[model samples]
Target chain A: MLLNVQNLQAQVEETEKQILKGLNLEVKPGEVHAIMGPNGAGKSTLASVLAGREDYEVTDGSVDFDGEDLLDMDPEERARKGLFLAFQYPVEIPGVSNKLFMQTAVNAMREERGLPELDMFDFDEYAKEKIELLDMRADLLERSVNVGFSGGEKKRNDIFQMALLEPKLCIMDETDSGLDIDALRLVANGVNTLKNDQRSFIIVTHYQRLLDYIKPDHVHVLYNGRIVKSGGFELALELEENGYDEIIKQHQDA
Target chain B: MAKKLSPVAQKARDFYLHEAGKLGDASSGVLKQVRDQAQEAFAEQAFPTAKDEDWQYTKLTGFVQNHFAAVQTSEEVAGKINAYMPSFPVIKLVFVDGNFSESLSDDLNELPDGISLESFADTLSMNNELDKVFAGQDKILAEPFGSLNSMLMRDGFCLQVSANKALELPLYVLHVQTKAGSISSLRNRVVVGENSEITLVERYVSAHEEGAACSNIVTEIDVAKHARVKQVIVQQQNDSSYYFNNQFISQADSSNFNTFFASTGSDTSRHQNHLYMNGEHIENTQNSACIARQSQTVDSRSYTEHNDEHGFSRQLHKFVLDDKAVGVFNGMIRVDQKAQKTDGQMDNKNLILSNTAKMDAKPQLEIYADDVLCSHGSATGQIDENQIFYLQARGINKAAAMQMITKAFLLEPVEDINNADIRKWITDQLEVALAKTHLPKA
Candidate 1:
């Protein structure tokens, strides 16, 4: 398995209100899993917990990635361990150029992997290739990180970063939000281009529109801190047509 | 142990007292009023001791004990004045013992229209609307050393740029402390007319034959409507001197003011810059950088007030302290309720290059306007260790990596300077300052 989760439970800081209650899932390599949910569900919490956001406390859980303990690592450490999270809302770091920040992150990951650091020329070549694939403006790389970018531009930048990092497991949290049709197509294209049999992805979304572009091998309905129903891609179409009411009712009946 | 006066300081003090006595009674009624008030204030406010909060970082006892006499007007310093003219040809004003030298000064005949640069004493003698310019402005002149400056000031520079006029060349004023052991106080008043533009460079340096000289100087700038002014203060006094300087600037509507301070001298120095934006649509940019070494100490305090609506201010100060030196920065930004839509940002970053060296940075913001955005932050730390290690791991030696990081820390603020020439000059000086500092281990 590329990612293994067992009896996961998590809570927000200083509060006993559980956000993730005994969530269990597993993903093997090369599989695309879609997690669909309504508002107030544990979709974002699960994504944050896996990505090591400092705010969420994993009260009871065991997350193992490729046989290595995942929960024990820092956010940056998890990033170095081939785990990438495309944040719903990207942070803006002023005075730090995008090129410098991306290069630093890439070099940090490369250093951890025991790979030789890319020289300036080589780094430029790699960055150019990824940026071209994403069809992003090359000038944006010289500007300050995420400063003054539009919502759609920020989302595309997130995917662009993911493409650059080339993580083994990519967790894209609502990457389709705030994006127009054109931006959505470009983002989906970037993801499809980077897809390979050796890597896996966990796509979390509130709407089924994004799943249509990036087909998923399996779909799960997460409701009120738990994944209540699991099925194939057809399940996404069923939920999209009937809404989440039937799934919630069926889970309660069971 | 009694603090002994350096022979040079004694001579400077004698020169100051002699000049003050020669002025015997204040010549002009306005001068008499200002002088009397300043003397009383100076006598009432004892010299700031180490216990004083503002003066705690700087020790002034060694250079303050000797009551130096102010220098009288002299034709003898003309040779000294001509020797130090900057390489670039430009109009120059030489002040010896606070007194201006006309023979050494450039003739104003060739000056552009609507601009006036003359000796303060000459303006006083002519009674050329001096009262209208400085009348009732005694609060700023009443500070301890400021009062001293008012009471003892004999000769200084006075500049007035007419409305809507832009000077083709900069006005360079050199304040030379000629005699050691002399307490010299110089006062300068500059008025930028409405819609006019000008650049003023004030350079302070101790005489070659320096002793324990104390220089207390105050300069006031009044910027009028739609005007632009750039003021650069360069202080490179003798290492054995004690210097206290204050700059008070007031701005009118829609004006822009840029002030830069560069200090790399004096054993103990304190600089106070107070700015008041009294009109709408005014903007102020203030930058200060200091490099201190040995037992030197530099303390800088600034207050920026947004008294009108739609005004903005930005301040950036960087300090590089090494050896047993200390640098202190206190910046305050205040936005009144009437100053709606005001935006203020202040940042003070310090680089401490030694274990014994220290920096104290305090940035405060007080906003009474709900529509205002005011933020102030201060950070004092050594260079980043991780950055240093990363550079060192890349085949660069530890010492070289440290030098690179330290240089970057100092250059960060220098890069904000808009003038290319000034930026290059400051960068070169920063390199020299860093060379004198001890690089930390990676």
Candidate 2:
């Protein structure tokens, strides 16, 4: 297994409300897994916990990535070890140009892997290929990170960043929220281009609209925190046709 | 004997009694009358205390109670500042110990047409033109620090941009302080003629690490009709010293005046800005950044009066305090009755980095005109938890993430500077200062 979570238990730091109760997940290399969920199903909380956001406390869990304890690492360390999380709401970092922010992150990761760091010109040249693949605006390279970008642009920028930092496991949390059809296809296209047999992705999103573009190997329905049911790609179509009411009701009734 | 004088007052009396004559002090003139009146006002006001509403948060006892003497800087010592100057094209006027240093300053012989930049003592002493240039500032002599600067200041710059001429190069006035336990004062004036345009940069720098010196400065700007003046002031001094400067700006009909003031050093630094809009359809932009750390105190005060119709002023001031540092921001916007259709917006944002850091923000708006739009807001907050988590999620370490967010906070105030070199210089200094404060470690 490339990424494994056994009996993950977490709660909100502010209210102490348990969001993820004994959740378990596993992902092998090159597999694309889509985590579907109803409202309050702990999809976003799970992403935050995996990314090591300080707001959520992992009360009990074992997250192992590549035979190493992922829970014992800092967010930056996890990133250096090839773990990436595409935030649902991309942050606005003013005064920091896209070029500088990316260079810092890319070089840090490169240093961890004992690769030569790219200078300004080299980094710009290297990023140009990724930018073109994502079809990002040319001015995005010079503007502040995520500042003044429209909703679609912000989502696409996240994918563009994901492309720049090619991690072993990419977990996108609600990446399809607030995205138009064009933006959705563009983001999905970028993700599809990056998917390879050596890397894996756990895409957490709502709606089956995004699934049509980037096919997933497994589709899991997350109800009330834990993965209540798991199935193949057809599971997403079942949820779409019948709506989450039937499955969630059946789980609650059980 | 007269009643016992306070330490600050005694120092002022010593300046008048012992050091005034040797410094070529003015006497038997209108400037003399102004100086005498300023002395009386200084005696009456003394050094500010907490009782004064403006100085409630800023305590000056440590900075002013100690006696500071006058010291002359050597030519070699003054020339050392050239090494610290960023690579940029501009007219650089270097001042060392309140004295103009020709050896260090750039020559103005091969200059642009309709431009004359000279020392205040050289230009103002020629005629009574000093009365017109320093017109509005003298009325504010009741202000103790302002009066102290007026009483002791001997040399600064007097720039005259002739009518209808536009000079592209930035005129930089660099003040270099190398004396320890010394008191230095500078009064400068600028006159941008009608329909003319110019870029001016006034910088305060301390070359000595343990100087513990005090600098009191006042600048008067006279903007003629249809003239535009863009000024940038960067004050970076030794952490043990004190820096105080007040700028009085008078805007004429349809003129524009914009200034960006960035403060990142000094143990105690305060800058008071007063601008009067005397003309219609005038626009003014004021941007300030106060970064205080390591038991330092940084204060920024702005007072803008819109006295005419169709005038607009936008003010944004940022304060970032870390460690045990303290930051103060007081801004007052007054729109007069005749100033109809005037629009003014003042916003003060503060970021407190540590539990020990403190930030005080007081913004007041007084609009006598019913047809004006004026709004003021002050917000004090720690680093946004969401922003920090967002950066950390991208793999940046916590310290580095805080530094990045703080840099972005400081950048918004000075990013709009038209001169790329100046903006870059300011940004680089802010980064270095932020690192020195160990803000990233937070």
Candidate 3:
């Protein structure tokens, strides 16, 4: 399994408010799992807990990534170990050029893998290929990270970083939010292009629109805090036709 | 009744009196009168203590107790400052141990037409414009350290540019301190004629680090109508050094002036800046950055007065303090009643990297003009954990992320420098200082 979460329980660190109550999931290599849910269903919280955000505390259970305990590592360690999370709201780091930030990140990951670090000239050439692949503005490399970029542009940038890092397991938290139709297609296309038999994706979203572009192998309906129902790809189309109310009601009654 | 003076103040006064007595018959003229008045002010207003409002955040008792003798200048120390000089084409004026070195500096006679750069002492008697140049002496003499500099300063620089002339190369003034436990008093004057342009860079550095050296300096600049002037000052003395500076600038009609000041050295430092807008439609920009660590303290205070209509000014100051270091910033903006349609903005931001670091910032706006648009803001914060995590998620370690953020914070103040070479030089100096800093984890 690429990632395995068994009965994960977490809460907000400051308020002690339980956000994810016994959430369980399993994803194998090359499989795309779509996590669909309504508002306040702990979808984003689950992603945050997996990404090792300090704001959320994992109270119980274990997260295993490629036979190693995922919760024992820091965010950077997890990133070095081939786990990537595309943030819902990309951070704006002013005065730090995107080229420098990415170059540092890339060299750090390279050092972890015992590979030779890429210098500025080599990194610029390497990043230029990905910029062209994503059809992003070349000038974005000279600008500050995410500063003055539109919402759609931030998401595209995150996807561009994902393409550069080439992680084993990618957890995208609502990457389709705040994107127009063309932007949505561009983001979905970028994800589709990166997908292969060796890589896996855990897509968390509110609507089923994004899943249409990047087809998922399995669809799970999340209610309250846990995965209430699990089914095949047809489940996403069913939930899209009849809102999450039906599946949520069935889980509550059961 | 006479006020009691601190040990440092007494030593300075004794040295000045002995020096004046030695001059005897040679010290006679308007300069002598000015020096006498300054001596009186320095005597009355000795070294400021914690009781004074401006000195509240900066404790000077330890500094005032040190017995610093006069600086000793020598021809042998000329080659010590080559490492600090930027690799660029420029006319250089080198000052060693606070005295101008004739052999080390570039030839002043080779200067372009309409531009004059000479030693302050050499031009004192021959130049009749000295009276108008010291027009702001009264206000400067009010401060103890300013008056002390005026009373003891013997050599510095005088730069003048004629009307409608622009210089292609920047004029660089380098001050190198080589003696230990000594004091160097220096004064500089800059006057730019109407419709002219120039760029000036003044740097202060120390070659010796064993004992503390003190540099007390005063600089006055006059910007005529339709003139443009850009100035950059970088102070990177050794850890065991004391730096005190007073800068007075006046702008005429339709003129523009921009200045960038950065200090990342010295155990104790203080900078006082006073800007006067004398005519209408003038624009002014002032930016400052300071990095202090290991019990060092950096204090900066600026007061700007807008006396005419349609004046615009903006000031941004930032400081990065760590390891029990202390930083103080007090900025004041005053718009006169007759200065209508004045737009002024002042902002101060500080980043404290250590648990025990300290910063005191006060931004004050006093506007008597009802129609002016003025605003002042001061903010103090540590590195945001979210920003760190954002970098960490991208595979950067926590320490590297903190250092990157700190560098970015310090670079923002100098981003507006027009000359690329000057900007690069300043950035290079800042990077060297930043590399030596040890930032605690966020």
Q: How much lDDT does each candidate structure score?
A: 0.77, 0.84, 0.88
Candidate 3, TM-score of its B chain: 0.95
**Candidate 1: regions farther than 4 A off:** A1-254, B1-22, B25-28, B72-90, B96-105, B207-210, B393-396, B440-442
lDDT (tens digit, per residue) of candidate 3 on B309-343: 99999999999888889999999999999999999
Q: Name the 10 consecutive residues with the lowest summed lDDT in model 2 chain B.
A: B16-25
Docking class of 3: medium
lDDT of 1 by residue, B306-386 (tens): 999999898888888888998989889989989999989998888887788988787888889899988898888876654
Question: Candidate 2 residues B152-217, lDDT tens each?
Answer: 777788888889999888888888888778777788888899999999888787877886877888
TM-score of each: 0.63, 0.91, 0.92
Name the better of 1 and 3 by lDDT.
Answer: 3
Which candidate should be chosen as best, given DockQ against the real structure?
A: 3
Candidate 2, lDDT over the whole model: 0.84
Candidate 2 share of real interface contacts? 0.69
Q: Is candidate 1 or candidate 2 better by DockQ?
A: 2
lDDT (Cα) of model 1: 0.77
